[model samples]
Target: MKYNNFRKAVSSLTSQRSDSSLPVVALLTGLAVGAVIGVLFAPERGADIRTKISDKAKDLSDAAKDKLQAVKNKFHSEGHELADLKDEVVDKVKSKARAAEELKDEVIEDAKSKAKDLADDVKAAANEVKNS
Candidate 1:
């Protein structure tokens, strides 16, 4: 019976050969299985198993915290990149708008000068006619 149980356990562990679980899940499962086996085989009191479980829980908590921090760092970096791109786009738009305004002013000035020249020509012709 013991041999059969051992074989069954080995086969189960082997069948799950693929990396199906995340790191945290895998770690938790491993700790649970180990604690159960240690309790079953231990000659001492249940206090030992309890202590081991507590230690394993602490380790899992630390691991989860590290993973969360890594994710946060990645998001922060991406956010900064997005902000920089927005600034660049705004600056380019402002530059284009300033250029357009200058062009409009130059066109208006040219039109005014041409109209003035035309009026001066008309005045000169009228004066000549009067003198004649």
Candidate 2:
């Protein structure tokens, strides 16, 4: 039950993280489109316009690279967090399994002890009947 809840929570967080990145993608797309349109309509000499457009393209490219790096770093961080959570959950499960095994062993031993006691009582009763 606890594990299921943890899984659900992690899934929710992961989904939210993915959803948040969509807006960044859309913003980048819009910026690129706007740059292209602005470059096409500028009233400068052809060579000058080309140079300006090229510079603008380089700037946009750098901005994109920076944003991409940021996203990558965030993804890496989240991945590590997920791995740590996985390890924690695994440890919790292992401990729970170990506890369950110990309880099972105790229960089996208790049952065996009870059975032995019952057998001894029956034997004592049988001896009493024989000696009567």
Candidate 3:
């Protein structure tokens, strides 16, 4: 049987070497050679096979291109959305900054008013003490 012959061949070759990989490599090489021989001996015309392979390869390439374009479009749309979000965030920060500046001015004015009132009260107290 072919299996028995294959096993015998592998055993014979492995007897010559200690490495386990020798048998595996020989098996793979035998399979590759057999496949090449089979494909060469097949009844189909070589030209027809080549044409079919070319057409299928082209179809696969076009499909891949379409997928790539779709991804590009999605990324572009997401980039625009991100830009809009960035602008929104910047506007909000500017508004907050303006509000903080206005609050600072108001606090400074209030502190000045309070200081003037305290000074006036101190002057009035000193005048009263002098009169007494």
lDDT of 3 by residue, 14-119 (tens): 7777796796878786897786787699788988867886999999999999999999999999999999999999999999999999999999999999999999
Estimated TM-score for each candidate: 0.52, 0.66, 0.67
What is the descending TM-score order? 3, 2, 1
> What value of lDDT does candidate 2 attain over all alpha carbons?
0.87
83: Cα error in model 2, Å: 0.5
Candidate 2 matches the true fold with a TM-score of: 0.66
Please say which candidate is ahead in TM-score: 1 or 3: 3
Q: What local lDDT score does residue 77 receive in model 2, on the 0 to 100 scale?
A: 100
lDDT agreement with native, every candidate: 0.85, 0.87, 0.89
**TM-score between candidate 3 and the true structure:** 0.67
Task: Give the number of the best model, judged by TM-score.
Answer: 3
Provide the lowest-lDDT 10-residue window in model 3: 9-18
| Clashing residue pairs, backbone N/CA/C < 3 A, model 2 | none
lDDT by residue for model 1 (1-83), tens:
97689667656765776557445555766787787787899987789768887899999999999999999999999999999
lDDT of 1 at 16: 72
Backbone clash pairs for candidate 1 read none
Q: For candidate 2, lDDT tens digit of each residue in 22-102?
A: 576566656876877787887887799888868999999999999999999999999999999999999999999999999
Q: Quote the positional error of residue 3 for candidate 3 in Å.
A: 20
